[model samples]
Target: MRGDTSNYRDLFLGDVPMMDARAPIEFRKGAFPHTVNLPLMTDSERQKVGTCYTQQGEAAAIALGHRLVSGQVKAERLAAWADFARAHPDGYLYCFRGGLRSQIVQTWLREEAGIAYPRVIGGYKALRGFLLDTLDRALAECGFVVLGGMTGTGKTDVLAQLAHGLDLEGHAHHRGSSFGKRVTGQPAQIDFENGLAVDILKKRHAGHAHFVVEDEGQAIGACSVPVGLHQGMQRYPLVWLEDSFENRVRRILRDYVVNLGAEFVAEHGHEQGQLLFAQRLRQSLDKIQKRLGGLRHQQLAAIMDAALAEQARGGGVEGHRAWIEALLTSYYDPMYRHQRESKAGRIVFSGDEAAVLEYLRRASTMARRPDPGTSA
Candidate 1:
């Protein structure tokens, strides 16, 4: 049997498999990327045990937990765990605090199944704390550049080309706007932060001490940027990306209308997918109604609805350009212009896509070059 581990760095770096022995509710609330939830007790059982502990103390809780999970129930759980152990001999098991639940699983595996699997030394809490610390350290020590542009300038496309780019919106499964919601839901807040931290950790390990991240607000849909990262972004050097008004309209049309509709259809099939996609577009416009004001909101929504209808009838996507251009000119452009003006002092480079990409790549290359004048 392998010993329990507290080597959080190694675990993340190696992408080790993990069995979460916490309740399903706890796992749903927050969990690592590759970890699977194989609960030691169901949510109901956990609730009863928690109540027993609160009312009668540890011993009563312990007794009640055992009684609740005996006979066939116990055997079934044991089989599941044994199967996991046999399948992932390199993985570790964990509970919330690496306490009672994990210890029980470890013990049962040893005694009943003749297998001794290791548990994470401090379990979920410790690993989560480690990720938080990792993010904080990265913020404190690393160099960052924030990419800023008007809507539909393709900031994500630029980031995709850079080795040191951090895709914050991608991590959050959002596009960082009122209309940024995807066909699928965003990750849990904890999951978003964990994924971001892991990405930063992996990049830092690969000798990237500098990164480029898109300029975004504190929250992206339901996911919030960690406090330190958000604060650092406020001060980072700004690189402005630009494109023609016509090109911007086409980009937004492809991303939000055409591509988004296709995603929905692919996930839900043709009929229901088209219905939901149309609904989502209308809902997105409605969300900004207060900000856009009544008459203007009505005007934009009307254009959008008409566009969606035309596309639905197989009349082609050219109709979406009218609404997208109007939205960009009336709504998004004004707000972004103000933001750019406010951050004028921090704007180190301003260019179209290819120029911005070249500048960033050159900057990253220069930053990583060793100083031959200094001793190793």
Candidate 2:
């Protein structure tokens, strides 16, 4: 079954949810969208089984697993899985390699739970492989337009306006910045790649010649963009997003301060939440201290603290503009400029947000038109 794993790739194309039969630790590391964790074994149980297999042998491991999972513990797990299967009739189950773990899940689901749960042929490993291969194919078949801009230029907005735009930051959920951490943390690396690959596959399957994506560094938060896609981005035509510094600052205020503050308050109480938001921003800025140099870092840190203090006293969060503006000018702008220098001669055009959106929409329509070979 593992050898015939091609069918696993198309699972995401429909509304089929996934039931991850791997342990919670494994699922937490990375997972597909619409996946619910229905672990076959607890982490300790898996560890015990692994240790038994290593020290005793496969038969001993099997016996030990049977012993460990019997009675109440076994019944509870089976009940949970049956409940999930009943709800998601079309869902597939998967483990690490579509090996014994997944097979056992399928058998037990049928025999014990009276439910026939179809397991992925090669499990998560095969599905992930398919997505990775799909990404490579997509890059080869499709042309690309790279969106370039400094932080706060609202590049994400441009991507939204464009028909074929791909928001890498949105996929990663980190905004591709030190301070880009969301109230909800970023997805695991494996999940991030799968998400991106699905998008690419959809685009490629639609026969689009190319798509637009942001120019991001390899890493976003804890997740890294797949190497091949990143390379394609480097080689693609670039469109620079230009916005005024003041407008950018206001955008930042709206996002990082106003929007984020409300979310934090909703989660935590008002006072603690504001402090955490302020601290998070400060921590993000502190990460670039070496690049900022000692003096500039100190100056900015002071401004940042004052802004936070003012907010603590119920002053407007717009005071953060002082810190944000300074950080942009001193750190982000120069860093972008250096990177741009490296990207010299690569930029195909530069325009404000509206112009770029208009360009991207037209480009998307052109890209979607029938190819000469396929033309009637």
Best by lDDT: 1
lDDT scores for all predictions?
A: 0.91, 0.81
Q: What lDDT tens digits, residue by residue, belong to model 2 across residues 1-376?
A: 1222337546766646878899899998888878899888899999999999999999999999889888998899889889998898877888998888778878898898878778788788887777777777667767789999878889988888665777888898887777788887778888888888777665555556679999888998888888888888888989898999998998888888888878788888888888788778788888878888999989999998998888888757867889889888878898898988888789888889888887877787777845322110
Segments in model 1 whose C-alpha atoms lie over 4 Å from true places: 369-376
Lowest lDDT 10-mer window, candidate 2?
A: 367-376
Q: Give the residue spans of candidate 2 off by over 4 A.
A: 1-6, 369-376
TM-score of 1: 0.95
Candidate 1 lDDT trough over 10 residues, lowest sum: 367-376
> What TM-score fits each model?
0.95, 0.91
Give the winner by TM-score.
1
